[model samples]
Structures are given as C-alpha cells and as structure tokens.
Target: MHLYTPHMLLAFLLLCLAGAAFPCSAAPADDGSVLYSTDFTNAEGWITNSKDRFYPEIETGRYHYLLEGGTGGYSAYTLPQKVNGQFTLEFDVTPEKTDDGSSFRFGIGTDKKDSQRGPLLMVELANKKDGRLFYLKTVSKENSLNLVGSSPSTGSSGATVRFEDNTTYHVKLTYYAADSRASIVVQQQGSPDVIFTASAPVSGKIEDLTNLYLTAIGDGTSGPQAEGYIDNIKLTLSPTHAAGDEKDAKNNKGADETPAPVITSAPATPTDEPTPVFTPGPTRTPFPLPPTPTPTQTPKSGLGFLVLLPALAGGAILAMRKYP
Candidate 1:
C-alpha cells in the first residue's frame, strides 16, 4: 500500500507548493509608537468591564487580574497615543492574595468611562493595620486623589512594603515630561535589594497619559479580593534613567542606593525575508585506471619450443609436396 513514484508525486507537489508559499504569521506591526504592550499573549486589546466578578485570566503564562473585596475589580488597556513626552512603564508583578482591607492598583491614565472622570497615575499597595502600605498617587479632574509619594518602607511607619507570596516584583515607571514627574521603581526579581524607591510630583503633563489599568480594591463581593500575577507588560519611549542617573536618584534610600532601570533596545522587527544563502555540492573527479595488458606473457617459455617444432614440420612438408 505504498507506491507513488513520479519522483514521489513530484515530492508531494513540492510540499504542497512549499506550504502555500510560506506565511505562518507576520501581521502584527502597528507602530503608532506602541503606546501599549502586552504579555497576555492574546488578551486582544484588553478591557474587562467585569462581566461577573472582574474575571481576567490568561493562564500559565500569566495575567490573572482577579478582584473581589467589595467588588471594584478592574482591568483596562487603551493607548496608542496620549502619554505625551517621555515614557517608560514596565511590569512583572506577583502578589497573590490580600485580605485586610485589600488593595492593589497599577497605573497609567486619562481614565475613560465608568461615567467619565479623567486623570490618573497609580502604584498603591494597602494592607493596613499600619503595615503594608506602598504609595504614589494622583487622580485628578481637579484634585480627587493626591498623595504623591512613598516607598522607603518597613513598618513602624517609614512607609511599609511587604510583598512576598508569589514574590516576583519588577515594576518600573518613568514619566518625566520635563519634571512634572513620576519615578517609582521596585525590584525583587533576583533581588540584590530595591523593592522601593519613590518619587511623585504631578500636577500636569504625565506625558499626556492615556490608559493602562489593573485595580482590585475590595469591599462588596464580601470585600476581600485582591490577587495578582501580571507579567512583562511594557511600554517605552526608552530612556528610563540613564543620564548620570539623575544624581543617583537622590540616593533612593536603601537597597544600596537604588538606581536600577536602564535596559534599552527594542525596535527592530520588520522583515520580508532576505537571509538564506548556502550553495555547496560539486566535487568528485576520480576515475582512471585500465591498462595492464603486459600481463599476457603467460606462455612463459613454451612459446620458443612451439616455434622450433613448426620449422621442422615445414621442412618435411616441402619435401613431400615436391615428390607428389
């Protein structure tokens, strides 16, 4: 049950015409300067108006923004522009659960909907009883949130910061539209210290911000929901701190003078295919060996004996023929 030879049916029709002339995927390039980036792998333009308990989950690869506590769970993503000036946002969180007055908020803003109310910038952390508070705030349509900073903490009110449950942390924000300000930075991924470092000073120009959210304060679903996982989200106008490191960031206070983010290099991916040269196959010139005929002297010495016998016979025949 195996016979197709026409050179195997033309090599199976040239592998089905080279898999229909190559094209397994190559259409994700929008470049409006990438205002949004995702690691959700496929959360498709993100948005979650809580179709039921604020469900956001993109399994094993990470993106599990749940929220329940008094039920104000949120999730958002809108940005292709708006973030007007310098920019850089990073992500890779890991909290996992929260209970006492639960909290968690991510940021980037110009909020949109929930009945209009713009302006935002976040990095909250809450867990009070005076213990796990991390901060940095600014929500305004004319002064609504306004806290503006916190990050060198440990409790006893130096400002607290107790993350440790799935422990992943990497956050990084850097909005500096000529000093309207925004600079928090957290570490914890392969730590050498730095889970805090803060700065805030907003009044306007958060580089013209847009939207990028992830909230989960808790109160209604029995008020106690705040879990986390988020992963790799990124946005960049590059330059997150590397110009003399802003005077070493005024000594970010601990973890050995925190001054971390400076990783740049991303903006090259637009190919149509041009890199395939190989050419090698034509080397074999070895064929010449057929001339050994001198091996025919096999008569050895018998040849001389035969010659003598013929001479004697010829003489006798000549005499007989003359007599006849």
Candidate 2:
C-alpha cells in the first residue's frame, strides 16, 4: 500500500487553490467624457412651463422646479454641454399628492429634432394605477418610445423606487459601456442602498453625437392639480466597470479549478501461431507397397522344458564359480 506524504498533499492543495484564484483576465479601464453640472437655484438656463403660476423656485438652499398638467404642464432645462460613455446624473425629486399617472424623465439625450441620427437615453419615473413607482426606457430613433420589461409590472431598462407625496428623495442615474455593451444603474434617496441595473447593446459607429436635455411629462388623471419638484442636476463622467467581462472572469476561474479526466490505454493482444501461406504444387500419382508374412511356433511337453532349464542354470552357476 502507498501512503501520501504531507509535502505532496500540501502541494496538490496549493495547486488547486492557485488555479481557482488566477484564471481569468482582468478588464481594461474605461475611457469617456465628463460633462456639465448645475443646481437650478438661480434659474440660469432653465425654462419653466408658465411664468407666474408654474415656475422653478429656490427654497431651503435647493431649487424647487415645478411641473403641472393642463394649467402648468411640462417644464424643461436645456444645457449647452453634451456627454457620452460612463457618466452620472444626480438630482432630487419630490412628487405632490395630486400627481396623476405622469412620468418624470432625467438624463442626457437628443431632442425630437435630431431623433433619427443620435444617442438618447432617458430614465423615466411614472406612477402606475396601483400608485407604485414604475420605471421606463425611451430611446430616440426617429421617434421616442417606451421599452417594456420581461414582466408587465417591471421595466426592462432600470429599477424604479416608490415615491411618497411631499417627501424629498435623492436620485442618481449612471450610464456606462464595456465591450460594446451598455448599462444603466439607478439608486433612490436615503434608504438601504439598493441598485437597479438595466443593460442594452451599444452601437459602435455612433461615437461623435451628443445631446443633453431634461424633461417632465404630465398626466391629468389625478385631477388637474398634479405637481412635482426637481432639484440639484449634476453631471460627471467616471470610470465604468464592464458587466460581461466581470461574468467572464468568474466563469474562467471556476473552469480552471476543475480537474480534467484521465485516459488509459488498452493492453495489446499476443499472437502464438504464424500466419498460413498458400503455395502452388505439382500434381503427382500414388505408388503401391509389398506386404510381409508372420510365422507360428508349436508347444513342447512341460517336463522336458523344465529339465532343460534346470541343467542350463546349473551349468551357468558352475562356470561362474570356477571363473571367480
């Protein structure tokens, strides 16, 4: 019996651990642009729906931008700056009690004029009939439209957070791409940090186009008195981590740890007899052989034979004694 030594066992274990740890390739760093930021307290480049009744106002050191339906419906703030790649847009939002089933859109993208040939990504917050916050995606391609998720209630683009009336909530939207794959992450204000992520394919050809705009769409279902507030619009680009590369790294590591199956060769068979060969021979005729005949002897009397045998034995004994 063979027993494994301590050193050999330790080496085997170390090899397994090393294979698991150092298997996959690391992802390359991201390269992109960082853009503009603003807190609309001074109402600089922002345009409101109505001048007197519905407009952006500064309160408690933060901007309170309002959007109403019918009387005051939809407000916008267009920026001169544009961005692409890994970027972040953060702001605060507070929905009013009278807010109907309207949606609030945030992030940077092209307007309706350049819809056909540019980049557009928007994160929309809309209230469903159940009063829960639902998220939607609208990418501009000749026309802007909503994208639905695998399930009916959930969005295919990003995660949504429920809104409380008159309650302030900080929101952030992140857009990044890796290996031609793009993704968005949305996180809501002051709670246990839960991140909602959505992904889609990125077109490699469209690299030069950029458009930045913020908008709010109104709904008149919850009476004509619906209202919402927006504040602290900031934009900046940062390094993005690749989603597919991360998964590849994990799978590669797992594959490296698994041992390959051993293969053994079958035993060879032995041959005892030589292989037979067929050769051509000349034709011949058979020959005959002569036969031999046997002879028979007759029996004598018993007394005569016994006497002759005794005399012959006595004479032989006497001759042997004389010679000795």
Candidate 3:
C-alpha cells in the first residue's frame, strides 16, 4: 500500500523545520567591565514603589510597567558604585504604548531613589514625533525636550527604526564623561539595523551619578495607556575615558556654546551586518566586544535536534520508498 507522496513528505519536513526554528536573544556590545547587570531573573536589586496599579513589577525575567491617568512609578536599582568616567549603557527595552503622556525616561543620576530630582543624564523616549516616528533624544538639566523640540533635527532613528508598538529594541547609550556627551544607538531585536541614533553633548556637569532609574510615567489624564518592558540590563564603566579625550573634551566644550547639537533624527533600514558598536565620541568608530559566554544563546543541539532527526528519517524513507 502506498504511503505519503513526495510532496506531502516535503511539506511535513518543512513544517518540522519551522517548528525547530526560534529567535535568539539580542546581543548588545558585550565586552566591558560590567559594573551592574540583570536580566530581571528576580526582584532582588530593583524597587518599585508607586501606587498599587500604576507601578512597575518584575515578572518572567522582564521589568514590566503600566501607566495611565498621567501617573506612573519607577524601577529603581542601587548601583555598586557611582556612575562616572567614560561609560556605556546597554539594554533591551520595549515601549508598548507611548501614544499618550509626555515620555519615559531612564539613566543614571545621584538620586538613590528619585532620579528626576537630581543631576540626571538620561535618554528620553519622547512623546514628540518627527512625522510618524517619536523622538529619541537625550535629556538632562541642560538638554530639555523644549530645547530639543525646535524642529529637532532627527533625534531620528539610529538608521531605520519603525519604533513599532510591542516590539523590543536593543539600545546602547554611551557617555563620555570627559565632554559630557551622550550618543545612542537603537535597533529592533534579532536585527542589525540602527533605527535611531543621536550624539549630543550632555551640556553641563552631571555630578554624583550614583543610581540607576527607569521612571516610566504616563499622561496625567486617562487616554491610551502607556506601557513598557526592559530586559538584559547592562552598565559598563570604561575605567577611563577614550585615549586623549580629556583634551578633546576641552576643545569640544565650545560645541555646547554653539547652537546646541540638535538631536538629529532618521530611521535606518535593517541590514545583515553585525550590530553597530558606539564609542563615546563624534567619530562613531567601532569597538569590538569581548567574547560572550556560550550560556546565553539557546543551543541548537538540544531537543529540537532530536525532534528534527525523525523528520529527516521520515523524509528519507518516503523519498526512497516505492510508490507503486
């Protein structure tokens, strides 16, 4: 008796292969002196002290936040050391809803608990948009959304970013303490296209950069609920600034005096190249990351391999069997 036809077997094999495939967790610039990091594996270091419903919570290895009614809370984490010197921050964040409210802010400051009340250097996922895309600008005592808003050049995509809803974006924000400058690069997970990028001087002395804060707030009035999730948090302090950058910092101080560096904007289309790495400077030179441990990625030789073996066997048997 005839069994399955060649076409049927081919379809089955394809389905099996599809079942075996999966996405890899996104990789940021991995090499550095990791001062602090977390995948939200638990709630040990973070504190969420907002009112009952509008506060952030730890769940499923992610920091999830829901905001509405113009109110919100923070995901605060005390750091091992104060944030200073040249450093880089990398993480995975998804803004589920920013259609309403002012914006969501995150970064380092002296405030152990209240970051917004201190000398903060943060990246603001602003509610303001350039055309259809929202602005990704840096904010501190000096760089406010109002100042950045004057036809803000592009606080644009690092390259090409749709900044779509409910999609995770891996971000790298590098700070050059020497010049008080911050540059940001963001890309959707599993891809290497920098959808949003900006390099602007932090503009003033950001002192006592002590704690880490991800304070996601919402519009004061009820509207579209603003929500977000962050994962794979990493903070790296480059023991020192890039070589000879202190002098450069002095030379570049005038940059702040000139028309403030507009948080230029644009969307970068996805590319097959590896993820782009940013050094704390204007050159945008490449920095090779140190080798990553093998544990992070899902292994290919696990259960999927075992299951695919049957598909391979079934395909071979059906292909060679007589159909008469």
Best by lDDT: 3
TM-score of model 2 vs. true structure:
0.50
- What are the per-model C-alpha RMSD values against the true structure? 30.7, 40.7, 17.0
Query: Order of candidates by lDDT, top first?
Result: 3, 1, 2
Cα displacement (Å) at residue 323, model 3: 87
TM-score for model 3? 0.58
Please, what are the lDDT tens digits per residue for candidate 1 over residues 85-108? 656677887877866766667777
Which candidate tops TM-score? Answer: 3
- What is the per-residue lDDT of model 3 for residues 1-324, given as tens digits with 9 covering 90 to 100? 457776677678776666667534455443348898888777577676664533335445677766444445666788887766777788887887776444556777655434234356565555543422433344454434212321224432233233556788787777766666666666679866544455566645655577787664423455645577778888887654554654444354323223334543332342455433322344432222322334345445467677777868776676857442
* Candidate 2 residue pairs that clash: 68-72
Ranking by TM-score: 3, 2, 1
